[model samples]
Target: MTREYKRNGNVNLFACFQPLAGWRHMELTLSRTKIDFAKQMKNLVDIYFRSADVILWIVDNLNIHNPAAMG
Candidate 1:
């Protein structure tokens, strides 16, 4: 006998953390498109770290995490 499997939609997680500041932000998005990645970055820059002179990010090798995606 074989067992059947069920599947559901996917949710992408975009998490940002500032360990020194003890701050964090997490977004749950339906798709992991370039636009979504851009939005997340925009939120980080325009809202979260607006006053910082420079912001550094450590990201995985996701296709959407590249510089081209910010366009």
Candidate 2:
């Protein structure tokens, strides 16, 4: 699933994909600004993917792309 939202002058775009018959999961999120991306990625990793082993992230060539962004 994909979703987009704007609040307090920030734009957020996110996608969540789940495997059909396994425990695999992937999530992607893009924000109009780097700060929003950092905040959202932190929340997502902490809440939904804390125990994940292999995380596959597909992100754009934005300046905010950081290794610390993923759990």
- In candidate 1 the C-alpha lDDT for residue 49 amounts to 94
* Poorest 10 consecutive residues by lDDT, candidate 2: 21-30
lDDT (Cα, tens digit) per residue for candidate 1, span 3-70: 98887878999999999999999999999999999999999999999998999999999888888998
lDDT of the structure predicted as candidate 1: 0.94
Model 1: residues with Cα > 4 Å off, grouped in runs: 1-4
Indicate the residue-level lDDT of 13 in model 2: 62
RMSD (CA, Å), candidate 2 to true, equals 8.8
| TM-score for each model | 0.90, 0.47
For candidate 2, write residues 1-71 as lDDT tens digits: 98988676544465455565454444444445566666666755787778978666677777667765433
Candidate 2: misplaced stretches above 4 Å?
Answer: 1-10, 19-31, 67-71
Error in Å for residue 38 of model 2: 1.0
Instruction: Predict model 2's lDDT versus the native.
Output: 0.61
lDDT of each: 0.94, 0.61
